[model samples]
Target chain A: MKRSVLPTIAHRLAILCYIAFALFPLFWLLKVSVTPNDLLYSEGVRLWPSRTTWDHYAFVLQHSAFPTFFKNSVIVAASTAVVVTICASLSGYALSRFSFRAKYLIVALMLLTQMFPLVMLVAPIFKILSPLGLTNSLTGLVIVYTAFNVPFATFLMQSFFDGIPKDLEEAAMIDGATKFIAFRQIILPLTLPGIAATLGFVFTAAWSELLFALMLINGNSAATFPVGLLTFVSKFSVDFGQMMAAGVMALIPAALFFLLIQRYLVQGLTAGAVKG
Target chain B: MRKPWLKRLAHASEPWLYSAPSLILIIAVMLVPLVVGISYAFRDIQLLNPFSGGFIGIEHFRDLAKDAAFYTALKNTLWWTGASVILQFFFGLFLALLLDKPFWGRGLVQALVFLPWAVPSFLAGLNWAWLFNPVIGPIPHWLFALGLMDQPGNILSDPRHAMWGPIVANVWWGIPFFAITLLAALQAIPRDLYEAASIDGANWFQRFRSITLPFLAPTIAITVLLRTVWISNFADLIVVMTGGGPADRTQIVASYIFTQAFKRLDFGYASAIALVLLVLLLVYSMLIILLRQTLLNKD
Candidate 1:
């Protein structure tokens, strides 16, 4: 029952290779962003530059619309995540603890929302929102993103809720607390990890949403990071260094949230997989 | 005795009360727009033209049926979706299996490998686009060094191979999704079965072939189905990278619909194209479900 030395070496090496492949592009992105303008074309494609500077980062941070874009993206993504999690927690709670006639229909409807090309909704959504003064507003983006994320977050939260024993809530119910109070007091506290995971997931999802932002919002004032970066890219097609610097900045929050919550994500996912 | 009927009504209404807020939002945002979007497929609904909301039946469909770009896009959609899903799934499965084994620094490695999934799709596209560029990027030079191309050139602008650029970006960005899910499924697998199999002298490959694959099958099925639908409808990468350019070679149905709506400002035509794509996807999903049903029945 002894494992071979060569096989273990191979396994370790393979994992390292996968990690390298996953990280190399991002590495190159960071690499190019710091290389000076002079060395950029001359020492082009070098793994590392002989000389590096923070000029691009400085310019992006100090003299660009990136701060505004960052603000807008934060507003849109955070608001969407918060709103979606609230709705999903309620819906997920309902699905987990209740017996209702429309349960199957509700599930099916949520699934149906997942299926269609959201691009189809573009025109109609724009049409519907234009009159309400919602178009070109962050609120509109939040509303659209909340609806899109609620279904998946509900499913995710439902799995986490399912993992908690029913007796935890039932016991609370029998102790004379209302179901709402029991859920708020007993259940929500236990699902903090799941809630964190959902918030992180929805934040990243909403952060990366580009098409709707592009379709619905316009002008520089309200542009999210994606739209802002896109416009920045097209506007300064020659300035690769600055653009990559901005890209690096955009990666910060989502990556931090992801690194923190990924363990919980896998945990929640395993719970769901077990149920399946 | 208490009124049991009133209590029963309260019990029945409670869950709905909990669920009502989400249901209301979905109906307003998703459901209503969906119906309006479907109706837009038949009616003229130009964004610019205030006079364009007239009902025109099947005209957009008829135009779409005849358009040659739509046909090319259909073909590209198949190739794009098929290659992306297949590559993402296999690599994801391999990575999941690799990580499932105990190793030192596994926690760090797991975080590193999954980092790409956190990168915004637009940034992923832009990052790869820069990578494929001849100036200030390493990928083309690497390809040149390997003699894969005559010169360090941008494949993103090459009509023959532009599709691969975005496909590669997509595969990289999407791999962790499958990996994370598959790894969860792998972990969900009870370890005792493997221990029992090994006690009977089964090798690793045999144990995996018989036990791991079967355990992973259901998760694999559902994840793959969901991913296929999701990726087929995903247009961000293509839209950002190629803009569905190099003469529409990379234009999938989703991006094509986006272009029709966003650029042309033709909501009616875009909705029509979206409707057709929706119908096709529904049929594909039904077929998969039925196929699984038959396979299950046979089992």
Candidate 2:
């Protein structure tokens, strides 16, 4: 019996169409970033501009507050990811292994956190932080971000821990290792991929956060990349090329990080979403 | 030999010790402020006004009741959330199915496709905005050349269809989420079921209905719930693309709250609107979960 090859061709064609749609905006961003200012309007709507230069990137680096924003974002997102991961690893382990009295309540609390509009917190957080001088501070952003991300990261990590067999730790306990030691020495090593996935997920989330950063941070000194970019867009609305260059720059670290960890992310989700 | 009381105490607290840090942070940062934020609705707390912190019960809500803008925003949120979620889910499911099938270079294709999810929401918003720009963007020109538009106007500026701009951008960014989760769910389905179905003379649609749909139901339900909540609260794209304008056509409840708080600096009013939204969302989530439970019981 012979099967027609039409289905396979159709599938490939459909996939290619998706790929084109997915990458088109990024392609446009890159294209405009390279196109010099003089030719920006003259060669408007061109897929590939006639002439290109790196001047926008050069100026954004030298003339803008973007580097400060970049540095602040790195600090905020990195710290939040690390802190959340550490907290989540422990809590996730508890959720996976323990049937404590508060387990249901804890799960419910996390679910409640997920349900509410975070915009509610803006006013209160600012009011609470202003007296203590946390508003407009990177430390404040990290604390708030860490809290916001913890619930989700904990859930994701719990799923990972669930995927890990209980027998390995049981074996370690039989060899006279305590729970913490066994967790540290045996199960933790096994969960490196999950940890990496958590870190990457939280990092991307913290990096992309805008409303909180916008509300909390005041000036270039503590402003994250999002705040800086929005300010740039509104203040210098005409400089599309430069703004696109900065935008492209912002895309690089996250795109690279997600690209590197996406495999483990999928693997982690395999143990996560499909299960519970 | 009996263990020491201290050791027993430590053992009893093991899970608590593991969970303490997260619990503490969530309460201090989230729960405490959530209560405080809820109270901010009953009291005035303007940022720029030093004397604005005063008890003003029900006034904001009364204003919100009368505020036509808030009602319009409420309607817009429904449209935005409903359209974006449905479109994203279907597209995501399609992509998941496509990726689930074995093909050459599937890995590269996935990375490229999922790349947008990694892009910061801010940039995703701005990039889409740029795409809709009449000058220096091809979308308008393409639309015009295709005769869909007479003059290639940015639909983001067109009040009647402005919401579609952000909805399209949202769909583009969010499809990967559903795709990823569904793809994971797809992979988890036992392969033998399909094999068995084929042997029993089940066609593609029959196999999918019997095996795939049943397996994917739990995931679909959960993702749809999560995405509905998340997307309803998601104000980034709307804020960036329209800033709640071309006459507040695309202003969602979340964005409206943000505008009230950030732009208007009206903490009391923003919190009031937020409280209403929170209540509404809580109701919606409860309904869905209860529905899921009833369906599961039937199953």
Candidate 3:
């Protein structure tokens, strides 16, 4: 049915308000990132900068340790995303398709894993890892992030697997293909959207993870972007321009990653919303 | 018959093989750590000498029972979860309803509203920190200019308002997830039901009450449950904003656990607090599941 004009206008207005509220911080981030350092204090709450400069960006990139942090963040997030997706895909398919004897128990246990606060597990995890010489390293962060992220990602992938018809894989299996072959050849290709979604989800999660990185990595050498941002805050004065610039810069990889995977993200969101 | 029996056996065995890799990984990575965490809760194991502790039994639990910080953290956690989840869900549903109607620019508007979820939580927190800063932050400046606040440092630095500052930031970040999920549910309602209601002379409110609310109940409950769990466990925003200070006023259980473990180096005591947190979450989950089952059975 066609909506009336009045309600349509109201709906548009409401949505516009919501959009403005959501995007205001991001717009502010960009606004402050380019505002000249002198204008930052004196602009007196202006929406747009009177004069714009790339000094903050240049300083963060060339003068600060942000470049190193950005590289480390990319390496850690990409590695964690790749590793978790691989592990979650294998496991998610099993959870979706199988009915083994301990399947219920395993599923319950996995759900249980998600229940406890990550902070609660930090000490024990540190204890476990510190003995293995895993602390204060990028590899440790990746491993920890991968371990923490896998359960949720597996559940995400499992739902996607459930959405796909099993008949396609069964048909492949019936044609004399081994189960792994069917999974690799037929099922995996269909689950690309799910894989992409999982990758994007896990990548951003690891990319922005701060608590573990703060606790586990003590020095500037192995810091992720979040920890690196803290360096902008010294004992006395906070550098607003530099911090905002770094914050804006940090958005780039995540934005690019999402841009690449948005097609799948949209598909994944709408997947089970309605019957075909 | 022999061939068919062999095929049945293979089918039965295949699931085990398929599930083994994940099960093993979960057990090694998650289950073992959990078990170790529980045991460590009963000890006085300091980080400096983790293995040097004897089983102190219920002493840690007893100590926690008397600790004022534990109580404060527990109270703050309840407030954070209750307020954040309820507000996020209400605003999310409101926005979802507004967007449910077809209008120009709906797609672009939806994309913009959902952008917060795309942004990293850390960055979101940092952005809000800047926004709430007393001197340089625009929010206090605007509030002062508008005469809403007598001075600049009222919101961010005050013990009373610091928690709410982070809560607002979190609600900003969380609203999009709820909106998207609830919007999906709203769109899934059969159009024919509304048509039937209108045909029966029901007005918009009546139709929404009779149809939309009931249908959306399950999705709403699940969403709230998920959000409750997530918001309760949320420590990052608080860590970034206040670090559980001016006087440990904003310390939730997660941040409390973090402080105990990392800052104090009292791993055993932290483990105890962690166990308390685990038990609390277990009870909450069980309660939600039971409620869900009851609701489902009624349906």
Best by DockQ: 2
Q: Candidate 3: DockQ? A: 0.46
lDDT of 1 by residue, A61-139 (tens): 8988899999999999999999999999999999988877899789878877877999888877988999999999999
Higher-ranked by lDDT: 1 or 3: 1
- The prediction achieving the highest TM-score against the true structure is 2
Residue pairs in steric clash, candidate 2? none
Q: Show where candidate 2 strays beyond 4 Å.
A: A1-4, A130-133, A162-196, A263-276, B1-12, B190-203, B295-299
Q: What is the lDDT of candidate 2?
A: 0.87
Q: Provide fnat values for all models in the order shown.
A: 0.72, 0.78, 0.53
DockQ for model 1 equals: 0.56
Cα error, residue A230 of model 3, in Å, equals 2.8
For model 2, residues A1-276, the per-residue Cα lDDT tens digits are 135588888899999999999999999999999999899988988789888899999999999999999999899998999999999999999999988788989987887898888988876787788999999899999999999989988876776676577998999999999999999998776666568767877898899998899888887899999889989888999898989999999988888877777666556544543443
lDDT of each: 0.87, 0.87, 0.79
Cα lDDT, model 3, residue B157: 73
Kindly indicate the candidate among 1 and 2 with the higher DockQ: 2
Q: Tell me model 3's lDDT, rounded to 2 decimals.
A: 0.79
Better of 1 and 3 by DockQ: 1
